[model samples]
Target: MKLDARSAARILRDPGALRVILLHGDDTGLVRERARTAALAVAPDLDDPFRVAVLDRDAPERLEEEVFALSLTGGRRVVWVRDATDAMTAPLKHCLGQASDTLVIIEAPGLTARSRLRTLVEGHAEAAAIACYPEEGRALEASIRQMLAAEEIRIDPDALSWFAGLLGPDRAATRGEVEKLALYAGRGGQLSLDDVRACIGDAAGVSLEDAAFAATAGDRAAADTAIERALAEGTSPIAIARSLLSHLHRLRRARLAMDSGQSRTDAMRALRPPVFFKRTEAFGQALSLWTADRLMDAAEQTQSLELDCKQTGAPDLTLCRRHIARLAGTAMMLRRDR
Candidate 1:
């Protein structure tokens, strides 16, 4: 019942007569969205009180009652439990033990992997558990394109990459930004870099992305300025570390493609989320400078930076700044030698 992305999509739509479906993860936006999808699958009209029931957290005992209740309207019933916690595990376990056609969709965002509810549902044959986390890399880029396309809008490739960075770890916020941008672009209008800046450009996400790329491209001053701007904008140290790790992992993938004998142009083209068009030349230079092994090393360093940032009383900003400086120096030395 442990669901990855592909299987999760299938299950959300069909659910295959599952009595209970649990959606849990750190990305509350994704969890909520998926929960809504699951609910709508069974009960199309959430407003219909008889067909769809929302469980009140204050009364966890109502879960079983809601699930067992038959619809007077003569269709499948859906019970939505929002802001679910471990306290509901016992109640959920009880409901899943019974026989009912009602679909119980649980939204337990930020649940730990080993949480009792997840363990129970994932282990159960009649129940399924889906972990909804934030999309990243290609997945995120594809989602952005899909959203824009849905609105009959097109974004320039470089602008798409920049806007992707500005999007989110939160699907809700991403949707909001996309909606705002779509409104700005209107129906047949195309989006440019200028358009992106004009709408939803104040986000610190792009600054963090800039810091990572600048550090890897040996632009120390640009890297410093980006890092400072991101910090000034209140970007968390851990978030910056995660951004650096994302860039390193991306480079590692591109390096792997090259090592497989693909031409540099083909390899870059094959990159997930595709490198921003403006960074193409620098990305190619970085590929030449950073071997696969070096990219892996950089990823490890970025991981360590995240760990350090999590420690109590750690000088997270200082540590993150120093890490970027070291990366910039490494990029410079590698470029000089190459």
Candidate 2:
């Protein structure tokens, strides 16, 4: 049996008495989502310990015994095995044969149509297979609209068209971006075309903003490369400064929005330039270590540095490089302070 992510939720709630439920997908998010569903469904009471058994596919030798043990354990038991490679096929098959009432959720990537595992699961009466792939076109748009609706946000068709172009194909990434757009709208508003443009801007702005984030996160190697590339493409020092300022401003706004009753997804949308949806978690991680005050201070410092670069006879490239390095170090320093 095959199912998509939407159907997985329903399956979890009323998962029939299958001896084994194999949840496999190429997309990491789908596999994890399904596995999580299985885990939670079998052990809805999180306090219960012995009801769930987790194993790695690499350790399939132990899986059969675990299957036998869990099948006899009280209520529904889950045996979750991750990273099922070809070498473990025999052991997995043995375990599947022995598994009685236990729900065996296996997470595997790189399984082709002709793969042995695929054949085994499809043939097994007790097992079900699910494919998790990147969304496209109408499917992608529908998901975006659904997520926005959840936050009480509406986007005009024009804005939705532009918004779709700016998002990544991954489900998590798509969900993340819409969340940013929604929160940016706040309560009772439609996401406009202008909002989408301002949030992600053109390709150049996207690259610069992503580079600035890399710098702020202490990835100096990536920061150096991204900064150099932007500079080579005629991105002005003032423009780079303004971009960082925009990022800082939004980080501050996102922090404030989060402090209010809004969710992080909403807070991200509330941000000025709108941090990419995929980056919300990183921004959240950044929040605990730094504050709006600190981010504003960094921006002010960058402004001063920019002024110094303008007033000096120093080489423009050299001065720009120095300031970007400093912006990159700000988060590290703030993290140390805490």
Candidate 3:
């Protein structure tokens, strides 16, 4: 049977006799969390020398033997295989055949309809194949609400939606961010949009990232405000400089791709989302004027700014602002030169 991540409660309530559950996903954190939860449900004591086996995929042929040993122990045992791949096919099949009332949990990378391992688990009478993909749209919105509720943290619907969107692609990161935000909010309190914005959205790390995007797009005003916001929110200057350098380094590569006859669409396909959309227009405008050399120059300037922020005793915020101003100025000159 295939299971949804959120439906674990319902599924676990009535686990099948096979007791062999394979929880797989790109999100290893979530996969491990589920496996841990399930294992504890069966064997609450981890240090009791009980019937519980946690096998890393890197382990040798010991996994198959471990499964068999744990199963025959008579007591209900849970064996979870982490970082599983195609190499575990033979071992997994062998264990499944001799489950002996033991629960075997396997975590693999994200699987598709064509995945052979997924097919095997789904086809089994007693086994379940749970697919754990990054949630989005309604699924993500619902998950954010559910996760907050679990932590006894209430969020307004609007704030919930905002966090859901902000947390794109990484469920584990989202969970951690929510936990931090909840801690910041304190006990017996609800988290507001301002809390979300303050803790997660407008955080120094997040702001620095935004500033880099703004700078790359030649939006000096936005970049300046983002830097100021980051600093005001207690973001370290060195961290902001490092983030800026990283963004510029990526931008330089995208610009080079454009220079190499790759169309904007193709280049955008290669670039990560939001970054691609945010800079698509600016990059197009930039391509009309700035040569690869100019972009490389900007990248080098970013590196220099990073080094200066780290090595020099100069105030970090001022150094970053000055470097940003110079970069914007250079971009303006390049734009005019076109």
Q: Order the candidates by TM-score, highest first.
A: 1, 3, 2
Give lDDT tens digits, candidate 3, residues 195-282.
7777775445667766766666566897788888877866556556556655665566666788788875576567532243444665
The candidates, ranked best first by lDDT, are 1, 2, 3
Q: Rate the local accuracy (lDDT) of all candidates.
A: 0.85, 0.68, 0.67
Candidate 1 residue pairs in backbone clash: 25-110
> Lowest-scoring 10 consecutive residues by lDDT in candidate 2?
165-174
Tens-digit lDDT track for model 1 on 197-290?
7786577887887888888989899999999999898777877887888788888898899999998999999875677677788778788889
Distance from true position, residue 93, model 3, in Å? 1.7
Return the clash pairs for model 2, or none: 176-277, 177-277, 180-269, 183-266, 183-269, 183-270, 184-269, 184-270
Per-residue lDDT tens digits for candidate 2, residues 1-338, read 66666775677656686655565554576567667767777777545557777777668787777776743347777777887766656766886666376777777866777777777777876767777665655676787887788778888776775466444434555565666777778867787777876765644446566667776765667678877877775665655665666566667777777777787777777654455566666677666666667777877877776666556475767776877787667766767777
The lDDT of model 1 is: 0.85
lDDT of 2 at 140: 67
Which regions of candidate 3 fall more than 4 Å away from where they truly are? 4-9, 12-16, 70-75, 110-113, 201-205, 208-338
Give the runs in model 1 whose Cα sits over 4 Å from its true position: 56-58, 72-74, 192-194, 209-238, 245-300, 307-338
Q: Could you tally the backbone clashes for each prediction?
A: 1, 8, 0
